[model samples]
Target: MDAAIESIRSFNRFFTRHVGAIDARFLDTDISLPEARLLFEIAQREPVAAQTLQAELGIDRGYLSRVIARFEQRGWIRRDRREGDGRIRSISLTEQGRAAFDQIDRRQRAAVAQDLAPLAELERDELVQALTKARLLLDPGAPMDFVIRPARTGEVSQIAARQSILYAASHGWGRALEVLEAETVAAFLRDFKPDREQCWVADLAGVIAGAVLLTDEGDGTARLRLLHVEPFARRRGIGDALVRSCVQFARDVGYDRIMLWTHTVLDAARRIYARHGFECIDVEMHSEFGDPVQGETWRLTLEA
Candidate 1:
């Protein structure tokens, strides 16, 4: 078929072989993959309802019931019926069940560790970062493995370098834009205040994928500055998440309004800004960035 479909099938084949999916028993465990997964979920969210487990595990109702029966017969689990509702029962692991789950957990951890043991530190980091990006892009609603922490020492300059390259590649911006971004980030690092102004990086799976800064404008207004998402990691909601985090942090720390500056042609970023209630307040033709471009300022009022 199409190149994309062929690529997907190729990846499927590779991943299946990598994970030993051809084996009869995964990790050479007594129970099969499905049974091991059920046990792990039960231990994690124990005292769970059968219906909940079925829904979460996406197991057939009949199959789940049989599995539960098998676990109970093995004294690994027990279903405690509610007092008023005989049909509704909660499932919990027995002492033996907890032991089994722990064993499985240790094996899984060791297996993953052993698999990555051959890679160098840099290679391992690249592996994790690539996998994390793929997962976020593939599953939009999945919980983020990203953290928005304060910019580390010298990270502002690093961020500036990244932003400069990204802007040059995507928007055809020149060294002027790079100078602008670098000077702004340097000033932020030089005169940072923990209480009022904050610069943050969207660190995903140990990689800095995005950066944003909220600076206090001295009049109950905050300026969102230097919003940049990695070019390779776009359309995965990183930009949206970073903006939302900055706004929420602003609101939490007592800001009445937020403002930002951007070029008119940055459609994806503009979409994220609009999604966060920012409206364009000013537009001007500028000779900067090697060509005449319409630079726009957007504003959003925060409610109390």
Candidate 2:
């Protein structure tokens, strides 16, 4: 390995060891790291599927099965067949499991805070900024092998469905699904001309987790549209990849500025846009899909 890569790997090893020690000290539980992480995953969402655990953690199926079996044996979690899909079983935490997870969560936060306690507020901000810059520089369009291709015929519907379900479920936006009609989605997909517009779907490990669409405005501008990430696939940096892909596409296509419309309630999406230098250009109160939401328009200007 090159010197720089070697140095990074060495630092990573040290960091891992330091964090593991902190975890051991604070989380004072008998659970191992893998099991603790699994518990965390279970705690974060309801009815987390086994397949999701396997995909997110890159854990082997047999190992995951063993870990889950142990949790089941201990009455920490329960498994049941999904309502509509008898073949697919979903796992959820039991009352005892929830309590255990809460303990671990609190301890982990305390451990992290302790680790950062030595740094001053300004220093901590600088450290965070540096880490963010490094991540952007090192993994700019990453998880590469991510290719830009034509979206599948039914893909938009799937994307819209996932978006509606996630927003409604997480944000309490009632009847969000009703806003995503076939015609509206079809129009968005149809309007993208391959030569003037670009739509790319990100597939990590052969599963589509996110997508981005860019369309020329025919007025010296571009529209970034239909950016969606599945809830189960979040925090894997897939959203960042999708946003970067759209920004890069806009730059490549020689657009002077790129704009997108979204809601203020979508904090995660807003953060990704902010990281990409998109600034809010407009805001309005809008009632759509059965909710009164604050709509926001963001734009990013490209340098010559």
Best by TM-score: 1
After superposition, the stretches of candidate 1 with alpha carbons farther than 4 Å from their true spots are 152-199, 205-209, 213-224, 229-260, 264-281, 286-293, 297-304
User: Which 10 consecutive residues of model 2 have the lowest summed lDDT?
Assistant: 140-149
Q: Could you tell me the lDDT of residue 236 within candidate 2?
A: 73
In terms of lDDT, model 1 sits at 0.86
RMSD of each: 5.7, 20.0
Q: Residues 37-56, candidate 2, lDDT per residue (tens digit)? A: 88988888769899999998
Q: Lowest summed lDDT over 10 consecutive residues: which window, candidate 1? A: 136-145
lDDT of each: 0.86, 0.77
| TM-score of candidate 1 relative to the true fold | 0.67
Which regions of candidate 2 deviate over 4 angstroms?
1-150, 174-181
Residue 8's lDDT in candidate 2: 95
Q: Write the per-residue lDDT of candidate 1 for residues 154-236, one digit (tens) a residue.
A: 77888889888888887799799988987887777778778888888888767687999988787899999988887545666
